[model samples]
Target chain A: MKKILLSFFVALAGFAAHAQETTLAPDQNPRYAESRDRYIKAQDQLLVNMNTTVQQTYKAYDWYEAKQERKLQRYNDRRERRLLRAQYGNFYSPYDNNYYSPYRYAPGFRRNGWRRGW
Target chain B: MKSIFLYATAAILLVTTACSRKVTRIDPVDTPDISGKWNNTDSRLTAEELTSQILTEKWIGDYVQAKGKKPVVIVGMVTNKSHEHIEAETFMKDLERSFITSSKIGLVQSGKKREELRAEKADQQTNASVSTMKKFGLENGADFILQGSINSIVDAYKRKKTVTYQVNLELTNIETNEVVWIGEKKIAKNVKN
Candidate 1:
């Protein structure tokens, strides 16, 4: 009877060792797999969010810069015209005006109309 | 006829001289504010304000204590909602330069620059030798972001005017979305014509 009891205890120890050796995969727990997938998705979403935020920030500044450039160009053109007007008497000045003037192209005057005082 | 020719030649010379643009190359530091607009001098002043106010803020100390490392910073958009045309990029560049020169915090590139960096890294993965290639997921993410706005108020009566430019810059904690610091620099110019 003692031999039979000893054999039974040995068999129980062997069974426990086999069970310990056969470890369950982590995915065996549905919650564990679900949590891992959720974490990965969250990380991916975070990256997208960061990318979008920076891009939008840059886009806003780009628009502002372009607008400022256009404004500056307009101001510079206007200022140049004003300075030209101030330097060369008026729009009727020979060097300043591009419009057709009856006095400039009168009957007796040639190319140098201002010089001959036509 | 001789008298008329001489007068006409003199007038032509004067007009030509007046119309020709003469640009003198002077030191940028010595540039004068002739337009009464936002200029490099104002940008320099803004840099001074940033160094004095933003760097010395209590938030820096608090971040250092909590993180035990220098906080990383990234500069974001600076909107120009002003009366005159203001190039915010130049101002932002000045601010970034100030931050870098101070060495109080770490600065990282944002926007297209950052994308370019990532693309280089991605290219390295396939093209570079295994031993020499750089790995991903090692970027130093910014802890704080700085944003600002340039606002101006102009009061003009006839040819006399006072243009006041108020630059408001704020730094915020990226993770917590809490405003860590706010700095303002106001420059006012009075022009009489």
Candidate 2:
């Protein structure tokens, strides 16, 4: 019985040793295969990101152009209004809600169609 | 005589019309792009982008709030890793201009300019008066170094090609070697040759 128990203990030690040896042993993988695959994945992701970023840049440029155009239009509108006011603003009368040229002054001026000086 | 005068007048008119060239002076700020390449537009846009992003970032605010003054910076090496001979100086100058105009940050002289300055000061010590001589070693030491790279990729097929430029700028603390700020601006162009 003692001999039998001793054999059983020896077998258990051998199995444990085999398990450790196998655990520590290197995998029969190719050179940098796992790391290379991971690297390739990352590269692919970066490329994809770059592609999207480039596209976004185009979109951003277009958006900025449109915004600038809108701003210019607004500026032109304000400028046009200013010019119109400078040109014909004096002709307007808030009291009558009307426009009257000095050459064709309002009814207060004497005669039909006031002279240029008037 | 009459025919000669008429011919002479006509010839002179023809020559004048043919020789006269129209020269227009346009605003440099809103200059038009005639060629599909990196140009002033790109530089200006990049400067604006960097200024807007960098100035408003948390790093500048945190530094200012903590230090009670603007952070001093030195423009370091910015390499161009592109197929074309791209000049980083133009945009870098524009960036410095923005920093100065904004008054949110400070910029110090760098590179060949800095060296030239030191040389001039050394000359000043011997040549100029004691009060007029500029002293060295009292220059503002930059707390941060701004360095970056301009990388590009060209994808060409037949008459169509796409140019992508990535301008990556990073501000690092000179003492601690910790990266304080990083800003990236991407500009792309699609050309048909």
lDDT of 2 by residue, B28-60 (tens): 788776756778888888888987888889998
**Per-residue lDDT of B123-174 in model 1, one digit per residue for the tens?**
9999999999999999888999888788877776655667788989889998
Best by DockQ: 1
Give the TM-score, chain B only, in order for the candidates. 0.84, 0.87
Model 1, residue B120: C-alpha shift (Å): 1.3
Candidate 2: residue A29 lDDT (0-100): 41
Positional deviation of A12 in candidate 1, in angstroms? 26
lDDT of 2 by residue, A37-73 (tens): 7878796343332101121112212333456679999
Please give the lDDT score at residue B136 for candidate 2.
81
- The number of residue pairs in model 1 that clash at the backbone is 0
Candidate 1 docking category?
Answer: incorrect
How many clashing residue pairs, candidate 2? 0
Off by over 4 Å in 1: A1-118, B1-21
Clashing pairs in 1: none
Off by over 4 Å in 2: A1-118, B1-6, B9-13
